[model samples]
Target chain A: MATTANSTKKFRHRVMSAALAAGVALAAPALAYADGRVVVFSPPSTDNYIAAWQSGLKKKAADLGYEASFIETTRDQSEQDAAVQQELAAGADTAGYIWWPFINAAGTNSLRSLSRTGKPVIFANQYPLEGTESLWTAYAGIDDFANAKTAAEMLLKACDESSTVKCDKGLIVTFPAGFSAGADRAKSFRETVDGKLEVLQEQPAGFTSQDGYKVGSQIIPPVKDDVTWVYTQNDSLASGIVQALTEVGKTPGKDVLVIGGTCHGDTSDLTSGHVIGTEVQGAYLEGWYTMQTLHRYLKTGVVKDGKVYAEATPDAPPSDEGDISRYNFIPSPPVGNSKEAVEGFRLWGWTMDELCNY
Target chain B: MSRREIFMDVMFRTGLMILVYVGFALFIPSYYSVRGVAALLDGAVVIGLTGLGIGVTMLAAEFDLSVGSLAALIGVVTLNFINGAEVGMVTAIVLGVVIAGVFGAAQGLVIAITGINSLVFTIGSLIGLRGLALFMSGENTVNIPVQRLEETDFLSASVLGIFSIPSLVMIGAFVLVAAFLRYTVWGKEVLAIGGGRTEARAAGVSIKRAMVVAFAISGALAGLAGAISCVKLGSATPLGFDTLLLSAVTACLIGGIALEGGRGTVTGIFVGLLTLRFLVGGVSGLGAPFWMQNLAVGSLLIVVIVAQLSVRQLKSRHDAPALPVH
Candidate 1:
């Protein structure tokens, strides 16, 4: 009787241990699934470039085994603050936040609100004002000054190639007056080409093809014969300048060289030689690095606040800033006038087809 | 109204338009050139259409703030139908305009049923429709397929060296709307309703039907403008027509359209649009800074309103019976 009772007790103990093992196996996958969540606070997804950037970030985050979500904000600051509050209330174990502030000054309150949550907030695209670094973990975006400087350099090269059109006088069809990015880009272009080139006129056209066409039509007819090169803020504006120049009997790439400051809109202009060249702002790289940084912060619990260079050519880096920056500076290279330059351009592992999905 | 008063009123409104053109022509020599005039007309076509739409609503004692959003929405929708749904350009445009008109009629029905102010109702739609536009286009500019663009190329084609198909369309719309407002019994009922809703209702006018028809017409015209602009641009963006609302309202007011409804002419609205476009194009051509252009527009709006008020006050006093005592 004693032997039988001992055997029964051993059998019950074995059953309980197997059941415990099975439960542990099931909970392991669930734990892995709930590893960490990354929340991205972005502006309205209306812009093609912004949409592309978000898509890249989401793709990278998913690849890195992190659950990523996005919250969109309008131009209103109060609404952004409310969204942040709502996100914080509903989220748990939030690894970090990727923030793209729409307007710099109005975005400070949003930054302050996010800072109180003790989660690292990564500011992308628009750089905030100085002394606001405490509110964000780091900044990641195209250096507009560098971008404009690159455009100036390209314009100078184009002028040097031609003998008839001296690089002395040029026209700048600018973005709106007070916008920080436009202001910085215009200022940088002027400063870089101050002694080398004489800017004939700088007109502040709002950032649209229509506005560009309007301003270009008004200014191009009068200045067409005089100006050597036209520097537009983006390809959309560059296309407008081409149209206006055509209307005035001037060929864009022939009579006057047109430099699209950024590569956006249809790339057919680049292939057809309407736009001489443009700078690749590395939007995809900016997004990929943003996600990678978030994953690193989650794993290490240490934020490395420094520039990241994800460029096409490993050898050619931005000459202005050497590899010794504390903040991440993604590499933005200039594409030449040839179709090969556009087709051959690559960032990290992604091709132009993947980068410019818009 | 005496013939002299009528003539003076016509001169007062249209005279301002003529003076603006002459002033720009004199000061800015390039403003008189063919290219300059063509550019002005090209810029005015879209806004002029929107202004006419708003003018129609104003004539019926209603305001359609959703015209701008409707324009953007319709443009995006038309492009989507062509690109995403693979529909023919003509079919897509007609479908887009019809859908916009239906939406407008629905809003009118809501206003009629609930007795809500048209302004408030359209303001809600303005926000909602903009949101809907963004959603429909996924917040990007929907590009029309290259093959489909040839069908709509007439929008950009110059017909008479100075006029494009878009400009002709604007003119046709203006003439059609003017004739409709002047000849039809429904048009007269709309005017009467605007002048005095209580009296119109007492006289057995179909207020609900007239309001719905007026709003539908406005929506269809706005949609047509959007479709034309989309073809011209070769793409349709969700926020492309953001500035249309303020500009259209300013054009209506400057054209001597009564804000309280019951008064305005299509010809006057067209002239007002031309004046505004000339000011914008002329100032930019003359090297005026961006801020100055905005200031000029704002100042012009305020000056017109204040001057009209002053004139009305003077006329009322002049018409008052003479005092009995010294």
Candidate 2:
């Protein structure tokens, strides 16, 4: 009987050891990477550009082994504030947050709330306003001032290209007030071309083709003969201007060169020479950079106190052992009005269709 | 009302529009000619049609807060029907309008039966309909294909060098609405309800039917405006009508349409739209800042409202029976 009890004890000990090993094997991957969630706070995907940005972020999040959970508001600051509170309540497992405010300048309180969480907060698409640099870990998007300046420089070349018209007098059909980028771009362009080109009028329209059509149709008739160039801040707006000019019995390129500052919807105008050119400020590329910057912050936990424009292709992970700069802006390069402009144009390993068309 | 009275009323409204228009023309460059007036009207088409639709609802002592959403929804639905469903453009547009009419009628019936406040109920509809528009559009601008662009090119083409098809449609709609209110029994019922809701019910008005008719007309007109604009603009965003409702409401107020329902005319609404159009376009054309436009429009609106109220008080005082004692 003593010998039988000893054998049973040995067998039980072995079973326990095997069970312990199996449990350790099962939990190894989980222990190695927690796969926490990255919360994305943003406005409703009300347009393709925003949708593309969301998609780009989603892809980057997945590749980094983190799931992206989005909290959408209806472009309302109050709604965004409420969303932030709810998100903060259950945010312990969050890797970080990528926030896009409804109004960039109006929602500083919510931005402060994100900063208080002690997790990296990355701003997407829109750049944070001045004096709020401490509120965000990093910002990744287009620099509107640089973009408009680039277009203004390119526009100088088109001044002598108009065959029958002097491209000296121009009109700027810009974005409505309260939108910071429109103001930034318009102000930058005006400052750049102060004496070189005469800005006859600056009307605040919307960021859609319909707004362009309505405003262009209304504003172009009286000054049709006087204006030899038109700078619509959006490509969609440029398309509408093309139609508007044609409707009013004026040939778009021959009468007025429509310079699309930002390449967006309807690139056909570029191929057809209706729009002289537009700078590539790819929303997708911007989104990809945003996620990369956020991930770099999560990995390194260091944010340098300065700005860097990402002029390279397919933006790299932060340099110097993954230290993300404060503002990571994508390049905005001007392309001419030809098939060669969009057919094979690449901004940081992103094709025109993959970047601008988004 | 007698023909002479109708003629006098028409003449008075026309004379008022002319005087205000000429006054604006004097200060606004390029606005003294026929082309300028046409362009102003053309730009005002969206607000004008929306104002007319809202004006109809106001005439019944009720108002619609959902017309803007309805416009966007119908535009999206129509574009999808044409492009996605591959239907004829005209057929798609008409179907969209009919659907809008049915939707409005349903809302009207619900409101009438439940005795719900029009403002509160229509605000709910506004949110729901805008959601629907966003869903149908996939959060993108529903662009009509290039092949179809030519089909609607004529809409933007100048008609007689003074008007586009859109402006003509707007004018025709105003005329039709004016005739309906002046001649049709349902229109009079609407006016009567606006004038005195209790009195109209006591006089055996089919309140439900009248509400349905009013909402249906408003919905149809609003849909037509959206269809025309979508075709003209080559696309429609779900948020295309973002500022349209406010502009239309401003038009109604400027046109002296009483919010409590009963006392406004289609002519007054048109003139109101014209005033707003000329003010905004004129200022912008002359390179005045947006704040200046706001100030000018605000001052004009204040002056007009004050003048109308003073006239109304005087007329009421004059029409009062001479009482020997209080």
Candidate 3:
């Protein structure tokens, strides 16, 4: 009788273990299906503007009842590919992906890898290369040509009003060479102001206020008397230019007209009248709309093609296939020296304070 | 080691520095002005400090490639302590320096125990420490309020109407390091070890202890440099000092420091730092295009290294013993 009872107890234990294992196995698909996370492949997390974009993306994702996560990549293209591969291997049920392609041409491998995941991939910040659109669902960012044209026009207008400085000669302090946006902006600015202005010097001041100050200090002193206007690709560089000019006893607005091409941070220069004008690059709105477009595609089973969105708003509903191109351009409005202009600025429900303050 | 050799070395380096200054003054008129000199010296402070640290390690026959990363790490830590943790400025600076020294000692201990190549070990530390900095700072630029920087802004202060506090600090560091190497028994032992580890061991020197101390001093100086830069910039950025390691190494090489170890002068290093800063400043002032500026620096460095190598070969031939007449 004791042997029989022991056998029965052993049998009961095996039965319970088998049942538990089978239950977990049955629920595995449900757990996998429930994950609605959107992964953002971004540049190094240290960049202030990129951080702001991610923050906006996360905020928008949360509001839409979806979870958002980020995978940091070094500027190296292979590193970006590796990061995407590692994420995919984890087997999470990802809703979609946002790719910020660290280097535009070098990022083709990353795009191809994400395409294998069979999820919609939205190219953010950096524009994708040609012939790689099959892998990318849509491109959402500022139009580099239009943005540069706007900045050039602003500088021309400033030059026209100033009586003391000649409108014919100017200097451009731009981002480092080989950067797509920098190259585009410089080309467009030169073309737009071709006959109107003669570019005395085009220097790469980098994207930091310190570099800008150093470069400006070195270049401005010799031409302090002749140069009419100084155009910087960003506000940090513009602020640096102002500091360099001020150190030499030259008033920025009075001695030389300064324009910050992109207003991303520290609008004090704009507000204080150091810079004559700037434009809203809408970094936060870019991140927000990338996710929004991805969410729409996932919900509606339709891809919006060739439609250019303005001010982070989708102009048309999702289409199956139409005359829409692959590119979607976000409208970036210009901001002037007036306090009212700055205060009244809004891009996709975000005020300047929210977008500019990282 | 001969007096004539020593004199030639000093004169050669000093003469080169003077030539560079005169050249810049001729090409870029503004480079000779008081403000231009001030700006050049100001720019040299951080690189000079880093070069000094590299000089120390090179003197001890060890290579610390992580000096730049260590400086960046300490900068981040010091700023975070003062701004984020609300630690007092003095306490934060002291703590940052101490931590850096300890980190150096730990690296020394690893090299001492494992007997690994100092270059490889420190290269690993270089990569690891930069990642650590990024992690600690959340990969963000930490901005300190301008008011928070005022008390510790001695690095940027003008001292005697001619020199800034940072220039003085660099000078003071050179003096102290020179004195220590000349007067201290431990310093003598470090030189001996660099001359030959086997010979040093036979001569009753504590190789491990001396190396650890050298590394500690190097780390402390790097930390101080980072602190100065933090105060000067009023912000600590993750990649702010990325150019530091290359600049320091270039300064050392240009200063005539023997890469194989054990031979260099603080004075030579100082002049080298000044020469490099002037060259960069002068290039920019000359309105050279951005690409041209980079090409010029690269070409100059290559020429210097090749010239130094040619000199070494010639010196070796001169020192070679005469063959016995048949």
Across A175-283, the per-residue lDDT of candidate 1 in tens digits comes to 6543456767888999988889888988878656787899999998887778778999888788888889889998778778899898767677778887888877656
User: What are the per-model DockQ values?
Assistant: 0.01, 0.01, 0.01
Poorly placed runs, candidate 3 (over 4 Å): A1-358, B88-90, B146-153
Q: Per-residue alpha-carbon lDDT of model 3 for A171-208, expressed as tens digits?
A: 99987543557767888999999988889998876777
Lowest summed-lDDT stretch of 10 residues in model 1 chain A?
A317-326
On a 0 to 1 DockQ scale, where is model 3?
0.01
Superior candidate under lDDT, 1 versus 2 = 2
Considering summed lDDT, which 10 consecutive residues are worst modelled in model 2 chain B? Answer: B282-291
- The runs of at least 3 residues in candidate 2 whose Cα sits more than 4 Å from the true structure, single-residue gaps closed, are A1-35, A314-321, B1-196, B199-326
The backbone clash count of each candidate, in order, is 8, 2, 2
Cα lDDT of all candidates, in order? 0.73, 0.75, 0.74
Summarize candidate 3's per-residue lDDT along B11-110 as a digit string, tens digits. 8877877887876665443466655566566667777888988888887888889988898889889988888888876677778889998988888877
Model 2: per-residue Cα lDDT at residue B217:
81
- In Å, residue A168's CA in model 2 sits off its true spot by 2.4
Measured as a fraction from 0 to 1, the native contacts recovered by model 3 come to 0.00
Best by lDDT, which number?
Answer: 2
